[model samples]
Target: MASSASSHGSINAADHSPPPPPTASAPVQAVENNLLTPVALSSVSLHGAKNTRRSLLDHVFKPLVRESASADTTFGDVLARLSIANQKLARYDIFKEDSIRVFISEALEQPQPGLHLDCTNLDVSISVKEKSRLVLSAGTDFGNAEGSAYTNAVIRNILGGAETLSVNASTGTRTRSAYNAVFSTPVNGNPDLRLGLEGLRSSTQKPWASHEEQLTGGNLRLAYLADNGDSHALAYSGVWRQLTNLAATSSPTVRADAGDSLKSSIAHTFTRDRRDRAGNPMLSQNGWLLRTVSELAGWGPLRGDVAFCKSEVEVSGAVPVLNSIRGGLPSGISVGGGLRMGVLYPLPTGYSLTGPAQPSRINDRFQLGGPTDVRGFKQCGLGPHDGTDAVGGDVYAAGSVNMLLPLPRAGPESPLRIQLFTNGGRLVALKNKGKAGEGGPTAALDSRAVVNGISSAVCELADGLPSLAAGVGLVYAHPVARFELNFSLPLVQRRGEEARKGLQVGVGINFL
Candidate 1:
């Protein structure tokens, strides 16, 4: 009978016909006879893993193959097992690349004298090229919120455990200065589970909002990855926040929430990402992302300065358009758009909106504006403003639509593009804490009076409607960030609202 077998340089497999049933006529063969039987892992050799511990590799590889004393494994089964092990090793991220080779080998011990040849065993050899363990990087970044120079030092394969440690620092005009250190490691020897700790300090000046904030915090995070390309993370953070340098023109509401406060909360984030690349998505790709953050303060040993629940959902997709029209437009031209909506509601913690002193904090409020947000408006330019400062709002909604056009020489992989976009959004303060004094009149503590007061506040907030803007821009989607120069005009505006007209330049990791 004729048989065929295929093998690759990186992986190997062989097919063998079972020896003719022990012919009684032939001389009794040795127990070491070579016959077609399931293969057993005899030994494993690792190359180029100098800094990695042998035990670590064993932990990652040992469970991958079952050790069956009975020889009943086939060559194909060995290949499949090696493939799975290779994937697990790649997830460590310590290696530039890795390959596994499998081959048949003789068992170490002597065989009984009743068989023909040496017993066959499977041997797995893993070869990996370690990536640089340490790296130092520095660069300058520009964006609508700030322009800054940043530097970072990173160490991989920390303590030979495939862990990572990094320290970063940055200084800029709007962000002032910031520093952070982070350490991450696999959890309980599971590559798919991770634990991280972070320490951070930063100071930021918001010129559009006329306030400077100083923050010092530490966080602990745990993350898990599922087989379906989904990830979940849970974190606990405690920080001391100080808001100062409030301009004299700042609103009374802003001044009330200004001061040092403690924010201790727990948050969870789930993400399902299927995009081809995260940095700059392809024009013909389709993907959606949903993030919901629920935060609770004063849960344990921390101060309950603020409490709120915020959730946001965004979906984006791209499709080929005008492709059938030969001469009408370029071949790669496509239309891409996304929808985003978010809501923020303050949780009651005995903090009365109508009290002499409210517990709600200003830094916790939501602010929307800038070229990355609602374009055609200055930074924090949308929503309600206190004098010239944007105080932000308790509730806000924003949506945008955009068209992406390929540049003259742009290819599917090229990041250059021309884009046209229109954005609209609204921000509103749900209850007027400024009217706390008004509840002291006829029915001071009466429920009827409280009901009327909330009605009045809602009525006052109705003055600010949704604002709309449209613009055209040059977008360069780089692997690390996106750059844009746009010219925008507001189609609708509110009196006293500051709108950014004409050319506006922005640089950041995301575009709204």
Candidate 2:
């Protein structure tokens, strides 16, 4: 992925959900009071490991069920209420409502491909590489944070090696052909949920060609949800990944951009918090939890988690943060379900998520969107790492959280909407640099170099940071199409005082 184009053109990276419903107030307040869910839900994928539900609450309602064994919820009472809610559903099922009928059939399967398109303005644009990434996870199980569905490929220049075989593997196979070529995989994805491994093969003739990159890897993500009635829950997944980019060969750039990761996720309706849906798709409420995770062994200094996400939010659009850790895991679990928002905004004492409404117009300014979680410090600000700064990583990993909410007293013509958001993070710098003969992990970046990198990165963020961003504008929404525009004036600055900072507009997508 490249730097996002105009935020209002098509769909920029990072996805989003619906506007804040009145019901979201509870979760937002709970977060402020330190009672809402944590950040254990970002990694969960619906198609890499198991069957898919349509929403987050597909499995978040059951009792803790932990006889001290497998439980992540803190409020046991939520379980009791959950059961009551289920019992209340029998009547609806008897009434033959579509949603109720679907709920009764645990035999219900997952959904199919759902492709979309939206280009509201020049600032945002989004497109999909494929039509649908359906997961048929039936007789299988992935993790709780990641998932996969299709097939993909990646190639790396050994920085030098083109004459030697230089191939290694664990459970799968690897093959190299003429003119610098390599093929490896586990192919389609997880067998249970999908057809086969979701992977590919590659070849390159250039040596120091294009940064002489290494550590090549790829993953095909699959997502599915029950689209039978309404309030669909996510389900099943298929995943397969391979890492061979870190071949001993050196490269133009020290580190490789390939964040090789593969995982599958699944979510099912265990019960509901408000079961009396009355056949109203929007009003129907159920508790669910979707989980997916992927772990792949590697070939060199560039080894570790390739990709991971642990997040949870309300179907209504409020995000939950995971705070603690337990049961052999390093982080806590997200406890509820919700819509996926595109932006995380900071509030006075708390934070809020932001996203535009679907079938809406897109703006050209105040754009915000990109590859996200990697490279360029702007929007795509994250990369491969398990709490470690392989290259100028953040000590606390100061991640920026943005959210969407209704703007107060804004006119109908306003292109932007007010969203409560916050961004607080520590500075990051390189602790060590790679050596000359060595690549990525081999170089030794002394304190001087690390200090310099840190200062420069911080300065860049400071110069680009949008202070107290809260306003309204034309927003775009779609399964793929995405766009948003907002005005934010920074309140705290390290040096000067200039209120001339203009509005923020961003857009992104998987295809465009």
User: What TM-score would each prediction reach against the true structure?
Assistant: 0.79, 0.29
lDDT of 1 by residue, 411-482 (tens): 645778788889877766545343322112111233343344445534544456568899999888766567
Let me know the TM-score candidate 1 reaches against the reference structure: 0.79
Best by TM-score: 1
lDDT of 1 at 243: 88
> lDDT per residue, candidate 2, 1-512, as tens digits?
12212221111122232111222224545435642221111011111111122221122221211110122322233224334433432221111222221111010122111211210000111111211222122221111111112222222111111111122221111122211223221112111121112232332211211211122333433332222322323333333333234434424232333323333333232222333223222211223322222221221222232211122222222232332333433121122223221211111111111211111000000112122111112332222121222222322223333443323454322333333333332222233333333233233333355445445644554455432222233343332333445444444332211222345544433111
Identify the runs in model 1 with alpha carbons over 4 angstroms from their true place.
1-38, 67-74, 98-120, 141-144, 278-285, 299-302, 323-330, 350-359, 409-413, 434-465
Worst 10 residues of 2 by lDDT: 356-365
